[model samples]
Target: MNWNQALFPQAGPLRVVQGEARREEPSFFPPTHLELQLQGAPDAYGIETTVSIYPLAALLQKYPEQTEGSVGQQVKALRSLLENPAPLNTAAAFRLPAIDTVNASLAVAGARKSLSSANLRGVRYLGAFSQDVRRFASTDVRYVFQGISRDGRYLVTVNGSFSGNVLPTRESLEGSGYDVAPQPQDNDKDRARYEGEVNTYFAGVNSTLDQSNSNPEVTRLDQFVELLQLR
Candidate 1:
């Protein structure tokens, strides 16, 4: 289906690094959620970042206080709660400041509750220049995500470049008025490689989700085996 091509028609060549899917079981993690990690691919925009997806239901369960308002309101409330030190446990391995970084990234994307049932539920994106380009000038690239799927079970994120001195703070990367240029190093070979990789990842996700009673732990193992067999 050329998901990337369909999603980001204007985007240049993409490289897939590490694609992993894991189910979060209830234990000490607080809320149970599905986590999908799409890593690698330094886009033509000179942006390098990983895409992470989390279910909104789990997030609300973890922070019941933030669940009272609309999706946008919830996001805002959670942002405020995560930023403060009082809500975070000092003894816990998870640091408030680190979580604040993630929350800050989500804020940069301006994820909010959806007003319409057909619309996206929430999103949050943030990025900075690579270490090599940090000193001279900033290229102003940002990664973004959209909450597709009705249940808010699937959140898709990607890396791309945007215009203006300020980084992208929009809900959707598409139609965000970003100027994307093709990479000088990209060729037909790279394009084909990216398409296959993307397809494989999505196929695995669909297959895993189709099962009525899917064991996330076992599914992860099976996925790893399938990936190994493919190679």
Candidate 2:
């Protein structure tokens, strides 16, 4: 998939190292070979490769104090769905696509795990939007799943939404005081400061996907999921 289009659709500008100095410019990184391959996978799975849910700000305001708790419950429920895929296969609302994509990746990676509906959890919705959005009136929810290979040699954690657009967009970042605009010339000192700001911006993104520590395994699963997504 086009990571830039999916994750940074509204991204303004980014800082990059151009020669010895840094330059702030609107950058466009072509989709890598791997990304292209994954994107070309069959669509029989019935899952939306790029999921654009509602905004996080609306969800927080709607859930308020119960956000974390609500998300935890949603995760647990999704795990149960993974353990049982029968409902997913028959239920149209589940959107539980076939595991061919995941399984194929595992095979290429020499993982013995066979991703199937039985072992894979259905993506669950964690939060919802308070207001409607034109014809698309859906809530912003988090999706996650964990599975172990048949031989247990590899554990698979899938933080659903392959695009990594789980958090707010650049517009939201700008509203939060982030320098979404590019810097024309970045010195060493300016780079350091900008890097820190960038880190802080990501921290906010992390917080949006952060779940409670009640389940340590889930946390580890999330970490692994992130690793796979990065790859």
Report the number of the highest-TM-score candidate.
1
On residues 145-189, what C-alpha lDDT tens digit does candidate 2 reach at each position? 434333322223333222222444434544564343244255887
State the lDDT of candidate 1 residue by residue for 117-195, as single tens digits: 2323323222232222111112443333333344445433333332223233333344443323222247888777656
Q: After superposition, how far is residue 224 of candidate 1 from its true place, in Å?
A: 24
* Local lDDT at 184 for model 1: 28
Each candidate's root-mean-square deviation in Å?
19.9, 20.2
Q: Which residue pairs show collisions in model 2?
A: 45-97, 82-121, 129-139
TM-score of 2: 0.27
Off by over 4 Å in 2: 1-146, 153-159, 162-184, 211-231
Which regions of candidate 1 are displaced past 4 Å? 1-49, 67-140, 152-231
Q: How close is candidate 1 to the true structure, as a TM-score?
A: 0.30
